[model samples]
Target: MAIPNEALRKVLMEIEQKSIQSSQQIQLVKAQIAAKKRESRILQLTASEVGVLPSGTAVYEGVGKMFIQTPPSDVMLRLEKEGSDLKNDVTNLEKKLHYLETTYTNSRNSFEQILTRAGGSV
Candidate 1:
């Protein structure tokens, strides 16, 4: 079916906007994934370093604005748990990123088809 030029232009603009929004969302998700991976890596390094400490060594854990004395084993446990959680978060974010990328690609393809139908070039 053929659409009037004005209507086609409006539809094209809406599709372009959707594509841009999807692109932005994909970028944001990618950044979040990177940050999560970095955090996970830091946790692993911290755990490894802490592992080398003497068995009776004192460990301090930061809570809010204060550092409280904590057992080395407890600190290691917390780090391990946090690292696991961060890994899960990264996995979820990666799935979201994939979805956003697929949406962005589909929007671009649709936009191109609309332009072609309207005797226009992208």
Candidate 2:
């Protein structure tokens, strides 16, 4: 059985649209990774200077729209943990984005081949 040109065209269009959406998602994920990396760098820097601050030094932590006084030691530990979590999240997102891109490319190529066989321009 042979597929119709119209059906092939529709499938190709759908695949192209999905590819575009996947590309957009990848860009968003990349931006998130960049932001997370910046945050992680700042945290690492702060953690490195943990011994410099005086015991009585004042530190404020942001909680929503309010800032609460917090211990520097507590802040240092929290920052290190949060940075590690963000790094892990970025890694997982990168893997997912890679998979999406690979699948999108394969689907687009297959659709293009079908369209070509149907005497249609991709």
Mark the regions of model 2 whose C-alpha exceeds 4 Å error after superposition: 54-56, 63-67, 119-122
Q: What is the C-alpha lDDT of each candidate?
A: 0.90, 0.81
Give the alpha carbon lDDT tens digit for every residue of 20-97 in model 2.
Answer: 887788788788878878888888888777648897888888899999998988988898789889889889988987
- Models 1 onward score TM values of 0.92, 0.78
lDDT of 2 at 49: 78
| Candidate number achieving the greatest lDDT relative to the actual structure | 1
Worst 10 residues of 1 by lDDT: 113-122
Pairs in steric clash, model 2:
none
Candidate 1 lDDT at 44 equals: 92
What lDDT is reached at residue 35 by model 1? Answer: 93
Q: Candidate 2 — what's its lDDT?
A: 0.81
| Total backbone collisions, model 1 | 0
